[model samples]
Target chain A: MGELRRYFDDIELGEEYESPGRTVTEADIVIFAGLSGDYNVLHTDAEIMKQSIFGERIAHGLLGLAIQAGLFTRATQAYATLAFVGLRWKFKGPIKIGDTIRLRAKVIGKKETPKPDRGLVTVQRSVLNQRGEVVQEGETDLMIERRPRP
Target chain B: MTGSYFEDVPLEHVEETPGLTITSAHVAIYLGLTRELAADGGAVPDVLPLCFTTGLGWRVPKPPLVVLAFMGLDWQVLRSVRVGDTIMSRSRVVTKRPMRDAGVVVEEREVVDQRGEVVQRGRFTYLVAKRTKETRA
Candidate 1:
């Protein structure tokens, strides 16, 4: 079992965590298409995409969001994450293949849930490309288990 | 396949999609793509990944070939979607605004499980190309 890094009470509001960068690849797009059943030509049809405004295939916006979630898992050792409650996000820019992206997340708010054993932690996240441009930004609310009391 | 032109879409038009069952294989494929390692020895959580929920939006019926670009997505998972649950999706055109050669279409999509419970909902915005009389001819 992975070690629990932080409990609900341990997270400090406004604290930020930066993730290691990973490059988006053609394989990532194809795999995501297969998994999501999103065969949108903009993502799969290079020839057609070249005629579009982007002039080339772009990663699915949701793929970028999913990558950010993966990066958050690696950056913050939140082994106690119970579930993702919700998210409010905007896709600011296109994530082209080969563009390396990373996440900068900060704790924005916290609240106790009706369930005494768990609480909600809201994190504001910004997904930046290698050029430091924000490709996506949003807030995610996560339910986390509280630390066990003696 | 010719997609619906911006002028063709009607506001508040709703479409329902066939039911899709979320199986362990589907979850495994998604988990593999994201590389989200489960801490409990690959035990699938009662709550699915948020992105997966968004992914289901793609399965919803959309205006044919008119999908030009994915502008944005705002979503919320209202309830847990457990593995082996059969879910169906429906979308309604909420708003449409014209741009240069295309227009943006905002759709409110909802995913309901077999039990008739709302599992997820979101607004998906897309840029759909405007069909000209020349193209229609």
Candidate 2:
């Protein structure tokens, strides 16, 4: 199981991995709401939702994204990693409760920055639901090692 | 349709001071509201992150897109947000740019607290539906 963890020396650009889908939960939403202080009526208010375009309360896009932490962390936390240089996200549809989200991640590219200790690795991420529809898609620039270390 | 972008939309002003104060009631209310609308169950605590992220999202200078999900979250509870901490938010649109991918655009939302300290920053991309629309907070 731990084989999923890839050290800096292991991964090559263009390498890809797929993970099983996970469901979003109510408890997850509630905790995030309080932590960030975002209370949009559409996200929080049912009545407002009914009066709005969606006609119902939908999962916040970020909730689907946050679930990625569990999926990606499990895959990479064993390896020493650094900062998330940057991420690009796209919201195609609502990720409602009870929906299953599958994570697809791939190492697209790597660049050697001026720093001798670290390099920037670009990884692509996709959150797809049960029907095989992609709800969220993006690429992230993450930190990796410049060379294998003892 | 060919149209102008966020760069063309232009920033009328950057509000540095805290525009609003957040309360526990606000948190609870938002949680309850989202839960009721979503028709999901369990206590409201689970939904706090959703509210906080959205609250922080709106407070972002001009969110090109909303939080769909977060890839990583490292929350520090140095100070528990209380009912009367007078939570204040100062949001600024940090960056905006076009993407190479077909049918998409991206922007960054950076939010700070009352002390002019950063609280949250999110880089999100959205599919543009309108040829042109007024983009503002």
Candidate 3:
């Protein structure tokens, strides 16, 4: 429906993709706090956060990671993904409300397994805010299904 | 209760949270908010468990640290989580490096299913504020 599936064989190192942007919202932070049980005053108490170093409430670092995953999935909707294996992520900066964030990802590494069914692909991802500053960056390893025989 | 100050936190400290069952509703809400569809067989999405680590950390009986900022994360996913799986977290402080006014604490955290099998594990680093006279009172 979106595009033909991009199997493991179809991928190449150095390939790059940019995802659509989504703005962070107040409700997003509030709901995440409730669901995650992270009622840190930095997120819940605006008056208190007004005096903190950041000077205002900020989105959870993990929230930005979760959104990046969704954005990447939507960008390459036809990826033949099997599972997410691991990641090394850094929270470089704060994500404030109403900041439109986009994901820029590049294929950095690939490896084949003993079996021919699937392979691993490593992607370097940067979550960039509206001003073009990278707020979060990471490398994620994914297992992708190989192209099926006809 | 107040959060754990940098100077007061002890190394090798450990804590665990109660089990939380992953329901369809929880999964749906997460997917809906992220604008993603449900996974095959209603399996939980990959990042959901990672997000749950924060909640699980909060649920532990021990007081949380006075985190000024989240520094980084190194995560590994070993098993898949499904809608019916009940998960818990076990976290241990692995390292502590004190700075001028703040300290960095690294926690080795693992998420386990009802059977106590490790579903995922990772090290989370946070920047915590130092305990001061103002904070003491």
Candidate 4:
């Protein structure tokens, strides 16, 4: 486990964190489909997708990104995160159902802001399947609060 | 150019949807799925609106793209989305590159609140299926 209540001052460039694994389930895909209203055959039609190249239903691309958000917060040092300001992401491969995925993130860049109480940090994030293949990868920018001065 | 198929989508075409109010129920389903609790419990989860950007694509009046796959996204959150805020998405087709049987369509997507302030903006690249001889028939 990492430090709790981590502040901007505590983040170090090049530091990495890995999250606990989570298996993508049928419910996850179905729930995401309803939530997003994206009933693409690739995700919803099993028989139809069975004839496609993938041969099975795959999770929504944004669903994986949403899961990555949860895994990031769970794995990283508990920062006083303020806002998720930016994301540069790519869908490199398909994430099929029953695939267990985890996040591997590294602090790639950091910058100070005009405000004294907060700063920005950029983390290179990767969502890897159980086989260690990177299904999705990107960089996310987060605004974090600074440590309080007594 | 009248249809929404890969080949039919014209560049610079803009599609906008009516406002959809963000309710606590939507946030609850999202939070239940992601299990991500905002650092400030009272605040909406940062990624909720980002996910909604894709969902809002369904609300457009124009026919949907015959998309084969989602390629990627380059997104920036310009402002926070509060509970009860009504947000709408505006997507403009920026580029279209044809492959063999499919095409890559890139669109500049924006989520604006009721006040018409941009809450989030992004570039979405989608792999769309072009109408072939079989599909055209």
Candidate 5:
């Protein structure tokens, strides 16, 4: 009953994290593609994907970003936040269905904004494959409400 | 792309559409590759964070499974998923409105587990480009 109490104070900038990785399936890719309407052949068709440099159907890169959202906001109770200032993404490798992945995040910086009611938080997010290779990366800027302002 | 404009979307729209199904392996692989960023060496592997993956699975065309943000999202937990389960996802146009810059395609997604039980549902929206004037059909 005590695993969920860490906060911004518990972390440091540039620190890297690694989570228990899991595998992906082709069905997963199609569902995501079908649901999102992203018909990118690289993620849907194995034969077509095989022709790509990656040689297999890869999971949607957004999976990494969604992982960050799922982890960060809940762990820190950050969702009560005001606004997400920005986000950036990087796809390092192809994530084939059935390929396991580890979700991770690191605090790159934190700052108190000029507004008395809010502050700024920045994080570096990433996803790695079972091979320990980093596949996806991202950066986030969030506005944290700290107090009431006139 | 559905090319839904940023005007208005209705619930019936998604209801008319079909949901999608995926696998636990894919969910896990996405997290495995993403774990490198979580600082805990990773994010939630069991329950909490998972809702997001389940949620993302339904949302479609997100930033990157590895590094993007929800942009704007809303997810409902109807049930939970397991390792071998097939995750089903469905979405609909919830909102559409014009943007001064790029047009938007707000959407909603619902997810179900292999047992046909709903795992999660979201009342969120997605965006798309009205990049150039699309020809009227």
Candidate 6:
């Protein structure tokens, strides 16, 4: 883990964090396909893909986002994480197998929930491929607990 | 199955998907692929991953060979979903816009638990190819 347990108070707006990168592989796609049950031809049917514009198979957009989430969790140990509130994301480009990707995340906004012990943190996440191009970008909100009363 | 073309999608009728019972095995497989460890020793993670819900939505019925590409997503997790929860999904076209050879189709989707409470909702936009002149005629 990159950071110790992060509480609501520990998060600072505008602060950024970069995550380690991972390469997408064929096996990853197959496993994700089974887990998600998304057998879209674009993701599964190689023969059909040959005639498509992309000219090859592409990873599912959600799979890329899910991997980004894993990278976030691995980069920070937020013991106070309450729940994943929401997200608005765009898939800027197709991520083919063998493309390496990482996350550039920053705390963009925050708000206090009605519950005194918890708050919402909004993060701007950019998923970048090996070539430094942003393949996906989004903002995700997470509900986190404040530090326990000392 | 032939995917829905831009002109084939019905914007009003919400399509429902078969219900699926979330299991520990599903959670484990997802965690393994993502290399994430459960925060606790429960069968499912404390908060179910949003991708799981999105996956359920993808099972909704659609026309064949018409979906060009997935464009974007906007989603919200309204409540926590735990292991053994039976969930179903419904989707309806929210918007559609035409382009030169393709069109954009946006669908509003909701995932509901056995209690019939919506646990997740989102909009999925896709670029769908229009029927060729031959097919349209």
Name the top DockQ candidate: 3
Best by TM-score: 3
Model 3: per-residue Cα lDDT over A23-119, one tens digit each: 9999999888877778877778788888889899999998899889889877775577888899999999999999999999999999999979999
Candidates sorted on DockQ, descending: 3, 4, 6, 1, 2, 5
Docking quality (DockQ) of candidate 5: 0.05
Residue-by-residue lDDT tens digits, candidate 2, B1-137: 22333334343244343345555555455543333221123222222332354455455444333322222322222222333333343333434444442123343444444565544455434443333343332
Arranged by lDDT with the best first, the candidates are: 3, 4, 6, 1, 2, 5
Candidate 6: which stretches are off by over 4 Å?
A: A1-3, B43-65, B134-137
Per-candidate RMSD vs. true structure? 2.6, 9.7, 1.5, 2.4, 10.9, 2.4
Q: Which stretches of candidate 1 lie over 4 Å from their true place?
A: A1-3, B39-62
- Over A28-128, each residue of candidate 5 has an lDDT whose tens digit, in order, gives 56655543455544465567556545676667665544544554543343332444555555566667767776667777887877776666767777677
Candidate 1, residues A1-150, lDDT tens digits: the string is: 435568898888899899999899999999888776667787898997887778899998888887887788778777477777778888888999999999999999989989989899999999999999999999888888888888
TM-score of each: 0.89, 0.60, 0.96, 0.94, 0.47, 0.92
Docking class of 4: medium
What is the clash count of model 3? Answer: 0
RMSD of 3: 1.5
- lDDT of model 5, residue B7: 35
DockQ of each candidate relative to the true complex: 0.52, 0.15, 0.75, 0.74, 0.05, 0.61
Q: Deviation in angstroms for A61 in model 3? A: 0.5
lDDT of 3 by residue, B26-122 (tens): 8887887786655575699878988887888887667778889999999999999999999999888999999999999999999999988999999
Could you give candidate 6's per-residue lDDT for residues B1-137 as a string of tens digits? 35567878777777887788988888888787776667654545422445555566566555443677888888988888888888888778889899999999888888888999998888988899888866672
TM-score of 4: 0.94
B30-136, model 5: which lDDT tens digit per residue?
45443322222222233232333444442444322221112444343444344455555665665556567444455566665556666655554333334336523
lDDT of 6 by residue, A110-129 (tens): 89989999999999999999
Worst 10 residues of 2 chain B by lDDT: B36-45
Instruction: Return whichever of 1 and 3 wins on TM-score.
Output: 3
lDDT of 1 by residue, B1-137 (tens): 36578888889977776777777887777666666665453445332443454455555555354676677777777777767778787778899999988899888878788998888888878888887776673
